[model samples]
Target: MNEIVTTRLKPVSANLSRHKGVRRHAAIFIAPALAVYLLIVIAPSIGTLWISFTKWKGIGDEAKFVGIDNYKQLWNNDTFRGSFGRTLTLLIAGGFVVFLFAFIFTMLIREMRSKKLIRAIVFFPNVVPPVALAIAWGVLLAPRNGLLNEFLELVGLTSQTRTWLGPDLLFRSIIAGLVWIYTGFFVTILMAGVDRIPAYYYEAAELEGASARQKFTRVTLPLTWDVLSVAAVLWVILAIKTFEFIYAFGGSGTDPSASSWTLPVHVYVVALGNRSPILALGQGSAIAVVMVALVGALIFLTRRVMRRAVVEF
Candidate 1:
């Protein structure tokens, strides 16, 4: 009877052990990451949203529910409007300059002799810290004593050496700096997109008597359309979050001037950034939430606009 019972149990045990047990173990493997994400990302985002509706001083005080009072203030504030407008200008104007130069650079460097070296040189700015880039440019554009103005003076263009950091030109300078820093990165991305086109496409275009511009329009642009779409989406996201470049202006606890302030700077100034008596914690949190929403909507719109049937090789 005991031997018969053992033989029966062996078959049941073998059946249970037939599989490698990945399904049962997968939950255990993923649980840690899920826990971290919930704690860090989800919890903080929820907390921020909650804070957006409250009047807490970012201290150990109980939050007072103030409804949309913060948002009302922001809506009326001229400073906020200018900041938002600057962000838009950066997104549109800066984007155009970055893309235009990036495309030109991609086309030019693709056919150059030392293309790899040039590529690395172009990509160096993307790796540099945003603050450092801003500081370096700021020094070069300093009104009274800058390398650019000095050079202009040396070249007998003394009258042209105006204040680059003044109110009239400060925003333009920032936009231009953004273009310079980002152009290389987009160029690299576009080069990768264009490189994937097999040489035979160009050969066919040539056989059909296609001009240089015609080849670009017909073969290169069509094939790399997907990459261009992706690059535009990425650009919009990065441009929206532009903080460090403008924030570097206000070093240490000092806030950037109204003229130089971007949305992120505005958000920072409202929260804990105030040197005044009252800290508008709710207002800053609301601004951040609005920005998050804006970025999401733009990303969704970008995907919708750029969506197309895949052109597989």
Candidate 2:
């Protein structure tokens, strides 16, 4: 009887030891990722929040507590206000155009021969560095010697060869470029969603004598909605990260005109592009804090609005 009890205790002890070993290895694996996330993301964000409430030059100067002065300044400034408005236009107006073109192209290309090649061509812009594309955009619209201007001149539509880079049209030009760059990514996402849809749905719709538009509305739209929701969230995130295109937009070494400035560009302009450089670290940090808050709120709102009952086949 004593031998039997000893053997049972041995297995129990081994099981407990195994459980402890598993937990130890799990911590060992998770430790590095947690450390990096805290150091790189969370720590910097917290530091920025603190810096926003103070007047620090981000260098050797000591931070001076200013309470809410930076926030007030940011609000009172007309340029900052305009920059935020432009940011919204980019997020909403540009988003609408991107999704519209993406859906149209997805439908057109889905039935075409050589679709793989067409898809590759459409997706090429996303793969290229946005800086290169932006520079190319500037050259293509370069006031007088631009490709479009030259074409208009060649075609005797010389009156239409207006200054594309001037203040009047610069902001719209930026929006158009953004729409073009982002549309491809959404197209790919939407097409993948379309692919997952069963062909039987379409066949049944056809047997019912459903019109083309009817099939799209009754079948395609409902089935692919889950993907659309995900795509919408991604678009908001991508639109917020619209710095590189706008930064490289005004050509090399030139500051973007006030009309074309978005929130991210405004942040950089305040922090580094000032004639008295490094003077407004606190102000810039405040702008950054606002951007963070807005992004979080919009993402939450978008997720809520886009939520739908899952339509699994």
Candidate 3:
């Protein structure tokens, strides 16, 4: 009887094992997307990082291994260094202006009677294409006959009516142009964050007789911090990779006279300009590598420093 029972159980165990195998096969089918991501996204990013360690002219057959030479050039090259400096300046100044405007606009809209209309108007700039926004800004800030200069001249402030895109005002003008183009997007982001906060928090603070400033400082700031940090990261990345607004508004190509060139422009000037193909490719790739490193470091550090504390709300 025992031998017969063991023989009957063997077939049942085999079928159960086959079912487990089928489940494992299904799991494998489900994993193809992740595998593709590892190959496509993760692999390429790692490859670019490796290329940065090499002196690969963009069209080269073989990359010359030059560990840290590209980084060294970034530190020593005046033009590259200057562009990096301008990038940092924009990151801080432009980033702050966008954040401030976004925050104020979002708050004001929330308090408005016609909130939807106000929100739509505020977000209008974001709907406009970046290139068109750039062109419009160029017209507005044009040195001689710009709307700004015209207004300044009317006020008898002739000194302030000077060239907006000239070397002296190039950086600030670019910052302002970028702020105009980007503040709307930031405002929309902040508004979404603001919408998530519980109204009860404000009500409780109001009942406590908290001044407006105190309420903002104690209640609003901390609660909104997580979203604001996300916005900051986005702004930081945009500032580092600022190409469109500067390229379009500052001038079509690298303006030798304009002080607004950032790293992307620097890379274009070095790699794609009418200069010798070899030098252009070499220096361009080098600059590209450095820009990647700088931006990567910033993002990493930012994530480390500003990683949001999880809130129960």
Candidate 4:
């Protein structure tokens, strides 16, 4: 009877093993998404990298594999170099200026009697279309009839008037416009962080004879460091990827000397424009890969530099 019972249990054990095998099969179903990701994002990236090693002019029945020539050309391309320098300038100016404005706005909003109206006004620019902002800015900065130059003329500072959209002034104007549109977003994010901090801390600091500036420097800044660091990284990426506003404001394609070109604009001019017969698929890919590396490095360094343990209140 015991032998018979043992024999009866074997089939039950086999069925349990078969059920586990079915669960494993179900987990394999996750492969479809992974496969799609590889095809759409990974495969394209790999193709671009391969093309960068070739001298393919965007469209032809045949592509010649010219190893490292595209990269060598990039090093000597003055146009690409200029745009790269401007990109750096935008990151520094835009990143710091926006953060400063956002910090001040958040502070002022905390003490305001009517917060909603102020917030709506400040953030209104963010909702406006980019094309609209570019157009409005163009009107405001027109040398002959722009509001800014006109005001200067009224103040007997007519000598100071210059074409704000001229080649010399285009980059600065673009930076200013971006700052105006982007500062409010950072302000809103920061205000949320500020709101989370306990008011009792400020109250305690006040009782301890701390000035408003001291309280902000000692308490507020430290508490908000993580959020600010995140904003900085985001701004850096935005500045590097800046394209639409530049193109919308300045006519697209490579200019006489690429005066207002950023890296993205450079890619468009080389890869898509009819004026340049050079197919920049490879170079564009290289630029994109380099950009990704640069951003990744910056984020890693910032996290290291801004390292702080989260404070629980």
TM-score winner between 1 and 2, please give it.
2
Global CA lDDT of candidate 3, please? 0.77
Off by over 4 Å in 1: 1-20, 250-253, 274-278
Sort every candidate by lDDT, greatest first: 2, 1, 4, 3
Model 1, span 121-178: residue lDDT tens: 9889899998889888888888878989999999999999988888999889888888
Candidate 3 residue 37 Cα shift, in angstroms, is 5.2
TM-score of 1: 0.88
Candidate 2 Cα deviation (angstroms), residue 144: 0.3
Residue lDDT tens for model 3, 1-313: 9999987878865676678577787678779988899999888667766776776656546778888777787778887778888988888888888888987888778777887787777678777766788888888888778999999889999887778777888788888888877888888888888888899998999999999888778877788788877888888788888787677666643344436679887776665653333344555666776777778888888878888674647
> Model 2 misses residue 24 by how many Å?
3.3
lDDT by residue (tens digit), candidate 4, 163-185: 89888998888889888888888
Model 2: lDDT of residue 225: 91
| lDDT (C-alpha, whole model) for all candidates | 0.86, 0.87, 0.77, 0.79
Q: Can you tell me which runs of candidate 3 are displaced by over 4 Å? A: 1-44, 54-63, 253-258, 274-279
Q: Is candidate 3 or candidate 4 better by lDDT?
A: 4
Candidate 2 clashes between residue pairs 3 or more apart in a chain or in different chains: none
Quote each prediction's TM-score. 0.88, 0.90, 0.80, 0.83
lDDT of 2 by residue, 1-313 (tens): 9999987778765676678577788789899999999999999999989999999887788999999899999889999999899899999999999999998998888889987788888888898898898988888889878998999999999988988889988888889888878788888999999989888898999999999899889998999999988898888888886788898896455666778899998888888883445468899999999999988989899989878888888
